[model samples]
Target: MTMRSRLTTNRLFLSPFTLDDVDELHAILADPRTNTIGSGPFTAIAQTEKWIRNRMAAERDHGLRWYAVRQKATDVLIGNCGLFRGRADAEIGYLIHRPWQGRGFASEAVAAVLDECRSAGIGPVWAIIRPHNTFSIRIAERAGLRLARIESDERGPLHYFVTSRANT
Candidate 1:
């Protein structure tokens, strides 16, 4: 929430995180599908708010950029999507609300974010995809990212992607 987002798209808009968005954030991150790759869920909405606030504080403390993804038509937030801990290269991460999944929203917003980053001179946007997350892997490939590695973690193997700014 330190800086405003300059990115927007036809179906979605990306803006800096706001503490007021706790409810919507909870709606998305608490879903089973969303949590499939996250830390866990918050039984209390207040806890989600705490987490969001903590993320903002952490971003400020660590000098990172975070953005909130919202539906343009409804002005309803779908989830958080951003280049985590920014650099000339960044890690692309997104999670769609369960009801909104499988509708290309993730691909659309992610593509939009990628284009935004490239235009801002952030080259070679990167993402670490969970090995079993075929959906995200396909989405990244469709957006022109090339798999760079199959990494091992405590969970298991995961794929890493890096997009070419020249092709963007």
Candidate 2:
């Protein structure tokens, strides 16, 4: 079995992704409505499997990657959230299933991951949200990230929010 920290909050538990979670992961990623501006609602199960495999590899190599978030009472997988090594720092990201959106789950997951980052001695994580993704912007802010700037990419403008430790 894969070894990882199991993080808990009042309402949810966070565990690292494993191959066993592909089905749940696929269910969450299959809805196109969940695919916001710059990411995916995976086109196929195989694609989702590839994503899980990649995350597994990231855990093996870097000891950090997205996690599976589930409801504490039912253990039903509801989302994934975490950080990855970015060009300049750790980049935070998350996704909650369509049914779970707007319930504060994403913010809870993000806050847990931020605590993990602090414990791991990682600093200055950043969240890149597409402009108009107000829900995500709110989650990031509530999780203690502050907007630093907006930058345009091939996909258009993205709002960059960094941890309180990062300078504006």
Candidate 3:
């Protein structure tokens, strides 16, 4: 297994996306609720598979890996969390399955991703969220990121949060 597949937290394990995980990822991302904060819901399995392939390529080429977060006890894939090559800088992103929400899984997974970013010497990780996504904003804050600014776009307003420079 690759190093990207070995990240672990107290109750979770995080691994890089693989083609074999397409079905689980599709199940997680297919929900309209999951995408309401950012991209729209994925309607096809091909889109999820392509996304997984892109994540692998990002890790191979850009050193950015979106990890699949799983429960350590049952070893079930629960969601994905990690940094992606964003338009400006490395963006810290995460998604937990609908069934996994409200159980602190998102925060734990995000905390792990932030730890990985800091360990990798990547400073000032960014997290973009919709202004109304208060839950995610709280998760980002708890993960050691501070609100940087809010910007408006065609779609709507977005809240941009960044890790404190002291973390560098």
Candidate 4:
């Protein structure tokens, strides 16, 4: 789907990231809690800008993009969620700001994005989560993705959760 298309739920609106979103998105990315399982929080605003630029390019060149997740009421960006080209299939990923976690915002955003993927005929979405990331594992399971297998890379064990698909 095009970047103009937005995915919505009762509490969130998922829209494409724009250059203007750098400030707010950087706030979330700068928080250590949001990057516990990944490369770690961004240390500078330039990194956040580069990230937005790269995501925009991915949308333009590869039809893969991350949507900025915002609270519908206040229009504040709280996180991001989207489908990305994965090793085996399209993968879903999301990050909710620390203040917004535990309130079901991540789960809602993930469900909305998964619905969008399914509507676009994308199947067998995967959530390759670090084994120790119980928060994301629970979110994946809540979004109807089940643990398919566990694999290891240089980062260590990863739990590969896949959507319900016959081939998987």
TM-score against truth, every candidate = 0.84, 0.90, 0.93, 0.92
The 10 consecutive residues of candidate 4 with the worst lDDT sum are 1-10
Highest TM-score: which candidate?
3
Give the per-residue lDDT of model 4 (tens digit) for 25-53.
Answer: 99999999776656899999999999888
Clashes of 3: 0
Q: Which stretches of candidate 4 lie over 4 Å from their true place?
A: 1-4, 166-168
Model 2 lDDT tens row, 42-65: 878898888888877777777676
For residue 72, model 3's alpha carbon misses the true position, in angstroms, by: 1.0
Model 3: residues with Cα > 4 Å off, grouped in runs:
1-4
- Cα RMSDs, all models: 3.1, 3.0, 2.1, 2.0
Give lDDT tens digits, candidate 3, residues 1-168.
122457888999888788999988888889887666556789999999898888888788778878889999999888888877774468888888778889999999988877777777876789898888888899998888888888888988888899898864
lDDT of each: 0.74, 0.81, 0.83, 0.85
**So what's the TM-score on candidate 2?**
0.90
Q: Any runs in candidate 2 off by more than 4 Å, and if so which?
A: 1-4, 37-39, 166-168
